[model samples]
Target: MPIFLEAKLLVWLSPLHRESWLWACPELEEKPYAIVPSPIDPSQFYDMKLPREGVICVTSLFEFKGRKNVLQWARDHPGQEITCAGGNPLPNEPLPPNCRDVGQISPWQVNETYNKHKAFLHLPATPQPFDRTVSEAYLAGCDIIGNKLIGALSYDWFKSREEVAEHCGNSSKLFWEKIEEVLND
Candidate 1:
């Protein structure tokens, strides 16, 4: 299920993300971390200048075919730390030393993490059309960022990318000031 980001919260993304920090797993303390999308792209955006030490990587993690690819992906990259929650874990696999399983975090945790860090990262390049992570991250006060693969939307694009980002950035102060702007017109 996809979460619909309210128009009031979309404006925050407008400001260039300068925090240089990302909501990451506790295990990140011990490793060089990076955020990567679920549908891995070896070519697109390859060779990123890894962020400075302690700078969190804002990237996507995903639930793949009853097996969480994000977990294995993180394992493959020993030094990279990752954040994964909100769904069932990959069954029968041994927990990787670097993977920090936060379990299903409550919405409050998302909000708290957003406030304390740069943003809650999880822009998995999922082909399943719309990804609810956007709405969840925004509602939690994160600046909803997009992964490159952006396949589909739950509603018309006009409704999602537009209003959701608008609400996230709070394009109109009135929208943030007034509750009316939270819903689709």
Candidate 2:
């Protein structure tokens, strides 16, 4: 806190963090700060034109990521194919027969994974600073199924997949500009 208090600038990863962090230390308001989300490279995730099918969740299956909720939802929809990817697996929470736990995949495989699925389910139990997976999934042309707790959804520009994709396409430029401003200041 003291280090931050003495800093010339602070860069928050998302708008949600900017709000929540400021509330934690209102004194920080006196300093310059910028909300620069971690940029997602849209070039990696292709926009699928072909009709996509099934549901895929790319988040780690940690307890805090609402794994139990996802499991229950999968159980309720027994016929639906839910592909659960990523690691940090919880103990004893067996996946429903309908849900397939593919565990983690390489970065090169992420785009392919998103392309294979029609919908992306992101239901974190707590507020994430910013989940780039949401942005990646959005760019890959997957319909996002997430709660309001998704920090990226707070942005006005995140209205639709196309809108989010546009923002992400320019995210690198935006991020660097913010950094340059901070450096110059």
Candidate 3:
């Protein structure tokens, strides 16, 4: 009588942000995880780089604007660290590590990356239907920082970009306070 994208429930089953980001990077299918844009590959728009400033992968244009603000704040404060990667899910951005294919990365590998990274930076550069990045980072256990409010199925798990900036401007306590509020519930 009827059909579906795959016939299965196609569940959104995730702790928070994992599933959405996995799909964004086709190259990551084997490993399947989110990553910053790949500079070497122009077509597969993964992470965004600001010259000597640094790099960040945008979940979408909406996220781009939010990250820009963080960039400005980080510039003023200076000294923040970020790591990048990519794979097949992206037709736009290329993978940074030539051998350790992102699409094929195991959960443990993904966890390793997560442990080293401080937070997930998602700034919606534009206003669109919804950006799934917030959920991706949350699911992966990355401290999410962004402007776009993804009040979707998990309506309670996001914060405005402005909030993130405030936390950045203030002490680390504020940062965890916000994170606890959003994810703990």
- Tens digits of per-residue lDDT for model 1, 67-149: 34444455566775444455434435565676555566665454444444334444353333334454544433444334433
Compose the digit string of candidate 2's lDDT tens values, residues 82-102.
998887466466778888888
Judged by whole-model lDDT over C-alpha atoms, candidate 2 comes out at 0.80
Question: Where does candidate 1 stray beyond 4 Å?
Answer: 1-62, 65-68, 115-126, 135-147, 151-164, 167-185
Q: What is the lDDT of residue 131 in candidate 3?
A: 45
Q: If both were scored by lDDT, which would come out higher, candidate 2 or candidate 3? A: 2
Q: Model 1 misses residue 156 by how many Å? A: 13
Q: Ranking under TM-score, best-scoring first? A: 2, 1, 3
Better of 1 and 3 by TM-score: 1
Count of backbone clashes, every candidate in sequence: 17, 0, 41
- The sequence of per-residue lDDT tens digits that candidate 3 reaches over residues 34-106 is 2111011111212222122222333332223444554454445345543333333444543233112233445
Q: Which stretches of candidate 3 lie over 4 Å from their true place?
A: 1-67, 84-111, 149-154, 157-185
Model number with the top lDDT: 2
lDDT of each: 0.36, 0.80, 0.36
